[model samples]
Target: MLLIEKPTRPLKLFSLSSNKEIAEKIAQAAGLPLGKVSSRQFSDGEIMINIEESVRGADIFIIQSTNFPVNDHLWELLIMVDACKRASAHTVNVVIPYFGYARQDRIAASREPITAKLVANMLVKAGVDRVVTLDLHTVQVQGFFDIPVDNLFTIPLFAKRYVEAGLVGSDVVVVSPKNSGIKRARSLAEYLDAPIAIIDYSQDDAQREEGYIIGDVAGKKAILIDDILNTGKTFAEAAKIVEREGATEIYAVASHGHLTKGTAEILNAAPIKEIIVTDSVKTDQALPEKLKYISASDLIGEAIVRIHNREALSPLFSYQPDENKDDA
Candidate 1:
């Protein structure tokens, strides 16, 4: 006999202080209104979150990027999740555009904490049913969490942008500043139909100053790719390397642009021509003219819709957003 199932819970979207701009865009794309949420800080640097509307028996998705001030934003997300659980929300889905502490995924030294796994444990303990985030620093971080994780890619977004800008073909070469990032660079290289190259480091300091290109970058438009653009040091160093190797033009692309202390000025003075990043994190600091931000709201918004409907999210792995829809 066919059994009847309970009706699907009402869907709700909420944004935290980290990235309200992208949250609004996601809400717009999902055809949903931003749910009421009030978050404030106390004198002693404590965080408090309140859900203004009833969320009982509803499916809730919270948008928060744990970028700078990582602790505070992370706490806010935990509190929000707890609140949802307490309010009887059917399921709590978290959308983290930037997963902080991701680089600390491995124990490089003695007594070092695998902070990425620790953070995953915290979120799981705090009750995040499923996690949806953009490119993680390391894909293996997914294994750290027992909960389901949908790690989206920004390759298609970056590819679409450059393809339209006419930055494709043989002249274009995707370069990974370090060896570990070859997979990311290869994805873009395949998308742009360009060659792939890597900048390998050497034990000898003099060797570093000499030829570092693993593949030919001479007279090519070098596109440097990475997961995070933190200090701009790596990109700047790689830019100089490519420039010295006879690369006529340079470009940098990453999923999250933290633009930490002195990063903007550093990239501005570097040999790079232009830098492109997604609106995964919000920043008020003055950015260089060479830096541009595109929105991942459509990509994220579509993922949220599909997740809520219990649909597959594999297509978003290489999802390309339209110029009109994905540009910030």
Candidate 2:
């Protein structure tokens, strides 16, 4: 009889205060325990982090989304990365489900700073070996980081949900809220074998003008897709236009649901029949009646497993039931 030794997988997962629920789910999917850590703030508003487990020579993954209280969460993530590096972790992979400051990827006007680049620089300087984020505002933001960046897409997850909801058909049209989201909307449309539509609009004095529907949405079920749903104003406005254009049913999907500051109320009152979003950021607020959430745990967990095993992440971008085996 011959005995074979099992290979060791040196991976450690940690989570900041940003989104603990998603972190726990990821850990469960990865079949690992969440690394213990504690954080506290001083009376003067300074943060201190202490990692309770050994990360020496281990691949450390810190899960934190820079969402509400953006600055605070950002600082916490930076501190965690620095701690892991100083503690001799082989690699510090920052898994930021929702990368804040992504909207500021480029300077649209004179003398405006590209804060996204600055954030990338900060993370690199803080000793992050790699970055893992989902559905970046712009594909160009990937260039902001010199280190490896895995910009995972939630399209497969969203498409899976739409199929499970029985929304895949010719009568369903994926609508882009703005020109920027045309590519994302098109991807979803392709996945469902549906048509695509774009909403054209202009804003003046903080008010949105009535949008024009570019494709045939009349008498069809419209599925509006975007990267983030911030104030829900834009989403609501687009939904209204689709409804007015004779859309039988309106459904909105976004990768990140930054539904803050009365956004939920706006969405609830809007004509959208259902608003689906991912657990990229914490959605613990008083959610609207039509809001639905899908977990990104399996997607993220498989990515982590592949990264730990030094495998390519491209295949994970597409929907694979075998890959997301434990997402349920």
Candidate 3:
């Protein structure tokens, strides 16, 4: 009789210094230990990555969020990808929760470059097999990559949180700060069975051109929805406008909290009741009382499992925009 042994599952998880906590949560959910790795910067400021364990023939996923210190984190991820490829890993999946350089997807001026596409090209050249990210500033960024890209949506997560908090109802209204976020805000409104409103505004010469509300938000619970909260100026202005138009209460939700340059101070001083964001970007420092966070671990962990098993990711990507049609 001949004896045959079982083959081991070759799935490995690693993380850069950008976001280790979220990566640990993903590892825990996937029932695996985080892969060992060491990274250090040279005296003159260069990144060095050393994979501490063997990953040959293994499916490797490197979790990193290019947020604050953008260039440093970006370089770390790129170098790690190169290292994993040279180590003979079967596949390298780059999991970027908050993808930096995403907002620069298009060139608005004559000499400007499309940095987002350049970043995509860099990742591909570094030998990335797959890319998984959440709520990109522009959905079209996925087209810039030749590899399989899974753009996950967080509206369901926000809906779950609102449902748990008993904040879903007809009295609530979802407002899009800018035109680009109309679809996202609509999805949230549909989930909560609420109405959708839009804030029409323009920027000109250090002055905020007075904007108008498209839908009725008077006496309603207004929830501002956006993809990112960078400087907090957009959301702050929207909140103020909605309040001036008679919105009873104001709350804000963003997929990535790229808070910087006194953004926390601006948000805390705004008229909004609470600002909710995800753990997609690391929040190492203490945040203001008005700012809160929700974890995207379970969603990302399940996606990882499905990808490893070659399962359909559509189930996790389902969203019904026509479920509720009442307008406010």
Candidate 4:
């Protein structure tokens, strides 16, 4: 006879209004019902959040991504964390799938506010015990937090897709659309076992002038890696330069698929083969036939499982592309 044993303590998953679909996916993947919540706004534009389910002494994970309407979503996350703390939940973990304001991680100019650090401080102040975020604009932002934080990677998923598409080989080159993404591009390069190429760039009159390719891209397949694809100008310029350098094929990969403001048209006109990104950002229209999106939900779900179990989530950072396939 097989007897099922129940858990001594239950885990509770709460979803903020920020991104309900991804939150629901996480709960379903973990075999748990999403905790109920009622969110509203006052006449004065103040946001309010009320948890409808009991969470006392239970491990709680609140999911909210600070995307567009960034201020509102960020305020919601802060309020939720504070509520969870006062409700006596044993643990309060804030799972921000796409950490926003992450681009302003440092002060490049005098008197400039380090908004990323401010966000970190705000979370800690609002009673977040731990944090789980994916592909931050800068990894150093993790250091701004004193609490435990697991900075997840989207490269493994990208690598898997590339391997499946049979793109890994000596002829492929991973390109960083900007110098800021060189670190991320290098990580992908290491996974594909391919060389790295970088596009030298400078801004002039609100426009970008692509300089030259740092590595040999002549007669090689090219893959550009970035954390986010906003306007697609950087990508367009990089693709043009690589193609002019005699690259046979060009591909793009980003963790957060913001793909905003005519990105589709820009990408369509560019000399690119494929564009891949995760579903962190919701999209109603189907990605262009040339684009492929790999889900980071499983990786995120596994990280949540490990965090709930009090296990180290660091091991998930390493990439292991399968031998039979080579597409991410």
**Residue 186 C-alpha lDDT in model 2:** 90
> Which candidate's lDDT is highest?
1
**Cα lDDT of model 2 overall?**
0.88
The true-versus-predicted C-alpha distance at residue 28 of model 2, in Å, is 0.6
Question: What RMSD value applies to candidate 2?
Answer: 3.4
What lDDT does the true structure give each of the candidates?
A: 0.90, 0.88, 0.86, 0.82
Q: Candidate 1: where are CA atoms >4 Å away?
A: 1-7, 205-211
Q: Could you tell me the lDDT of residue 227 within candidate 2?
A: 91
Taking the tens digit of each residue's C-alpha lDDT, what string does model 3 give over 1-328? 0111232558889999998988998786666789999999999998999999999999999999998889999999999999999999999999999999988998899999999999999999999999999988888999999999999998987887777677778889999998778999999998898999999976788895988899999999999999988889999899999999999999999998878768877888889998888889885555666988877776677778778877777877763222222110
lDDT of 2 by residue, 267-322 (tens): 88999898888889985567778988878887888888888877778888785444
Q: Cα lDDT for residue 279, model 4?
A: 69
Model 1, residue 111: displacement in angstroms? 0.8
A best-first ranking of the candidates according to their TM-score comes to 1, 2, 3, 4
Residue 103 of model 2 has an lDDT of 92
Worst 10 residues of 4 by lDDT: 319-328
- Model 4: per-residue Cα lDDT over 123-166, one tens digit each: 99888888999988888899999998888998887887777677
Positional deviation of 298 in candidate 1, in angstroms?
Answer: 0.3
Candidate 4 — which residues are off by over 4 angstroms? 1-8, 202-208, 283-289, 319-328
For candidate 4, what is the lDDT? 0.82
